[model samples]
Target: MSLFAGMAMDEESVKAGKLQIANYKLGENVHLFGGAFYLCYQKGLINWLTDWNPDVLIMEANPRYIATPSAVKWMHARGRKVIGWGLGAPPSNSPHFLQKWGKRQRGVFLSQFDALISYSQRGADEYAALGFPREKIFVAHNSVAPAPTFQVSRPKFHEKPSIIFVGRLQARKRVNWLIRACAEMGSKPRLVIVGDGPEREKLELLANEIYPATEFVGAKHGAELTPYFAEADLFVLPGTGGLAVQEAMAHGLPVIVAKGDGTQDDLVRAGNGWQIPPEDYGALVQVTREALSDASRVGRMGEESLRIVTEEINIEKMVASFVRALNSLRY
Candidate 1:
């Protein structure tokens, strides 16, 4: 069969290192609910069952989605390969089910599908730790966008200090610590938070109360992020795993990324940015202070951010990995 190669499998993409584009789609959604699908399981199952016309059905990774035995069986009956993407490894709930399955049973269960895609080696490791063999589990990261071509050359940086945080204000994100860190500094640096979330009001209140210098610009996307990345002296994320790190780096902003964010475990390097020990709020504060102090280091590291993404983490590599994994599927 002819492949979907234009936008999906563009030749330019191959040059960028995209291994594969999904030729067939399936009964799954990834974004909503962190890997959840619509309700009405019985009706949804029937809808997916009758409409089964693809080779690969990527099941949503949440417990509700994978636990559907009938859903698994229906796709199998249709002569299709079922794969799971959008799965986070170490903390994934899949092993809870697979652990009870025996050695042969475990192999059979994991080996059945076309392939599983995860965001990082750590994520892939999460599955491997679960007894899911490496052959079956694939590390396919989210796409990394290209650096924008500004009409004007990016202006040189000033010695003025800045600290930026990008991500939701969710619990695990640990944004409050950042507000406090800003408070700790006698000559507090400008603490700018870019994303919006449930903690907005409270965090804003805390920032206002503790460190009035904090700037919560609410949520931002697209070109909106550029100014923040450009203006920032140092980028800081107290929480784990952020697309912003990639975005910030693309714009020549160096990062102070939190460790164990699953995705950051792959890219945090002394060459580019500092990996603040995860949950080490005091360390996060101290590191942010130090990062901003070295103006020259920040400039060099910012360039490194761009270099790292260009050389190692571009989107082409991601798409190609997907293609390679899918093509290798035993189906």
Candidate 2:
């Protein structure tokens, strides 16, 4: 059976609900409808599920509120199997305690489903680490619509060859490391940030005082970020995994990401982008300087980055893998 489960997917940045709904429609072989705590404001989802009575209760990511056993109970009570779908990252390689906890929480929430969906091989391993049997795991990559063919022109900006960083401005994101790296850049490459967070005010001051070339463009979302992506010679994130790293790569911008499990680890490879070990400020600074000094190398890296996404990673692959996993469940 087929189903469409919704959740708080309208939030800015990354929203899983919209992605899930699209996947459900694409995989129309089974019944589809809202399930568990759908983000849709209309109440009585329980009644809605009870009424439609599909073969499965489908969802993306880790379930919230009615996670695992409770959600499993809810669906089973209605004579339907609960099929959890979405990416799950392993915590084995992470140094962050919070990341480990969050991973564990997702594992607990996902374990109750008849089967779990994973966007990448790394995500599938997270489930295995949680003691989930191979039969209970589904592995799939997310997918996206094909982008228009661009001649890959710069966004009509000056050729400053700036080092750009995007994503939320938070300590966990480790944006400060980029700022510190800029200070160490003896040639003084322009360091530009295209996001905002609680660390904004402090980061702004820190940039102005310590690294004069550093600039923060407040918060740019959706289309506003394209120009930066188009103009940047290299993108760096001193933090963990984020879909943005893939977004950067999609835009033909190579990323210098912190080494660890996340979306970045999947994108940054040997010759495409740099993945320095976590908290390696000196190495971060050195890599930034080296990449900035060679304009040709930087451009080639950007092209390679885009190639990585188009060739190996796309939202469509991710979504398809997830749907296949959901459909393979015995329950």
Best candidate per lDDT, number? Answer: 2
Clashes per candidate (backbone, < 3 Å)? 10, 19
Q: What is the lDDT of residue 278 in candidate 1?
A: 84
Q: What is the TM-score of each candidate against the true structure?
A: 0.75, 0.72
TM-score, model 1 to reference: 0.75
The local lDDT score (0 to 100) that residue 93 gets in candidate 2 is 49
Query: Model 1: runs farther than 4 Å from truth?
Result: 1-43, 61-64, 86-88, 91-109, 129-133, 144-157
Q: Model 2, range 1-331, lDDT digits (tens) per residue?
A: 4343443332223334434332342221222345532432223445455566666776654443333354458788866777666666444445689667866776666667777776656777777887777777766555443432455654322356677888878777788888888887766667889887778888888877888778888878767888877767788988765557777777888678887644454657867888888877888888888887777777778778777777777766666665676667643
lDDT of 1 at 127: 64
Could you tell me which residue pairs clash in candidate 1?
17-316, 18-316, 18-319, 18-320, 19-319, 19-320, 20-319, 20-320, 20-323, 90-126
- List lDDT for all candidates, in order: 0.66, 0.67
lDDT of 1: 0.66
lDDT of 1 by residue, 140-218 (tens): 6665575344432344455457778887676667889888987887656778889876778889888778888888888
Q: After superposition, how far is residue 73 of candidate 2 from its true place, in Å?
A: 2.4
